[model samples]
Target chain A: MKIIADKPKLLTETPMHYCPGCTHGIVHRLIAEVLEELGKADNAIGIAPVGCAVYAYRYFNCDMIEAAHGRAPAISSAVRRVVNPDNLIFCYQGDGDCASIGMAETVHACMRGENITVIFINNGIYGMTGGQMAPTTMPGVKATTCIYGRDPKKYGNPVHLSEMLATLTGPAYIERVACYDVPHVKKAKAALKKAFEIQMQKKGLSFIEVLASCPTNFHMTPIEAMDFVKTQAEPFYPLGVFKDITKEEANS
Target chain B: MAKGKVEFREAYCKGCSLCVNACPMKILQISKRTNAKGYEVAECVDMDKCIGCASCATMCPDSVITVYRD
Candidate 1:
């Protein structure tokens, strides 16, 4: 019988250690699927930051670089500029590392129009290192930092990065996709492939902010976290192409 | 007629009752039987009325459900 669900060639054979219900595995598979489809797995370089997905370097089959916490964007920029200008570089980061601590770096990267594909995983709460409040945490959602609830007065409202980053002309493409369900997941994978293509074309910065789930941090079972992502988080981070600077892409 | 097979992975289910309330077709109901983790499972008895809206799978928390249509 054919192995329908074997690990993707873009990913190592190592088993992922994410929580049983976490969507990180699914998101990783989506990126790997894109890489495999494009045959760019051999040429691609991935930058992983110091958050829950810190050890992402181990899972991705391609050449990988581990960056300092909240520094993947800068590191990716450096990688693209110094080593190989023509190479495809992608930075895989979580909300804590991207939206919170590395906010300045990401904003500057987008503003600079760096030719890098940023696969941002926004699950609201920090997953790997403990359930901490992230900048993308939805209003009224509780995290370890916000025990009572994310008081908007103190924490402020969630920042929609796909929309916020798209505001800059530097980014060539910006879109939001989630793995809450199969159809959304399929769309998410397609957007991811397109984001990678955006970088391959050397058009400019391409950002795919995926709203993921953290059941362990969300204090819900994996299933419930999936529900929360679909029902709660999606409203704040509506999916679709938020920006496409290239005329052909914009028209397409 | 297009028949969609909805597969629910009970292992990741948290039983939040959102799918139960959100399903407009009323095809799914909380089962009296519990799964390995002791959570009430979501079940669909009469899938004939399913419009293939995919709202339940979309609204599920664990990313457990995969719907295949034929």
Candidate 2:
């Protein structure tokens, strides 16, 4: 007998609070798998934000702290300074928390090259807050606040956080991936693994932006939401490594 | 023939049917019965056709599906 696939030990048995078809569970499992594979579960500390993934502290089996709204980056920065160098510290934040309210904390952390990992879930809308418009919301996408579809004239353009963060020289690794389908899911997992590996190597900040699905908020079925991520979000956001100083370091 | 089985954690299943769509062998379907959480859960309708590719399990966001191979 062989176990083909089993739940990662780092994920608590608790049922996730995400609505049906929400891809947050996939990202959580990938992170949990990486934490277990890299032997970081024992010492890893995850900073959870106050959005859709606010209950992450209860889901991830490792030491987790619930940070104030969008303050995960700041909190993780402090944790990185005080904790032992070998311990892994990562912040799991939603687009609402990381890109909107906590934009300053996020930018400063990357600008200073903080030695921490950041898992950013960009589902476009502010999921936990009744699907309001977020900084990462795509153009023409309607949410509770943007009932008439987001108009660039008034709201401005969606902020491409990963690309913006890559512009700074502080981060050692930054990649954008999505959980739309099987192949994309695998790629997202691989990117997450690389992020964790960079952290273990004492490299600078490693940020991964995962374009997740908010089916309930999007008023679409789970399958339809996944399709939207592939067809709509991928074109606007694009996927691939934005920066990898570690690779350059190896070459240099 | 390969032997494999999948167990669904009924309590955790949201019955989104992503797993059903992911099944390559078309062995999965939403059960008419509902779990304690009141959401329908996916069930293996034709166990004999299961290849145990674990595609259903992989696509499951809830991590409710577990695969075993023998």
For candidate 2, the iRMS in Å is 0.9
Displacement of the residue B17 alpha carbon in candidate 2, Å: 1.1
Writing each residue's lDDT as its tens digit, candidate 1 over A1-252 gives 122233467877565556565677778877887888898888889999888788889889889999998899999889988876667899999988899899999999999999999989999887876887888887888788899889999978888888888778799999888887767877988899889887888899999988888877887866677888889988888888998777656587
Residue pairs whose backbone atoms clash in candidate 1: A222-B62, A223-B61, A223-B62, A226-B61, A227-B60, A227-B61
Please give the fraction of native interface contacts (Cα pairs under 8 Å between A and B) kept by each candidate. 0.03, 0.71
lDDT string, candidate 2, A1-252, tens digits: 588888899999898999998999999998998888888889999999989899999999999999999899999989998999999999999998999899999999999999899999999998887989999989999999889999999998999999999999899999999988888888988998899899888888999999999999999999999999989999999998999997788899
TM-score of candidate 1 versus the correct structure, residues matched by position: 0.78
Point out the worst 10-residue segment of candidate 1 chain A by lDDT.
A1-10
| Predicted chain B of candidate 1, TM-score versus the true chain B | 0.82
lDDT of 2 at A158: 96
* Candidate 2 residue pairs that clash: none
Q: CA lDDT of A31 in candidate 2?
A: 90
Model 1 reproduces a share of the real contacts of: 0.03
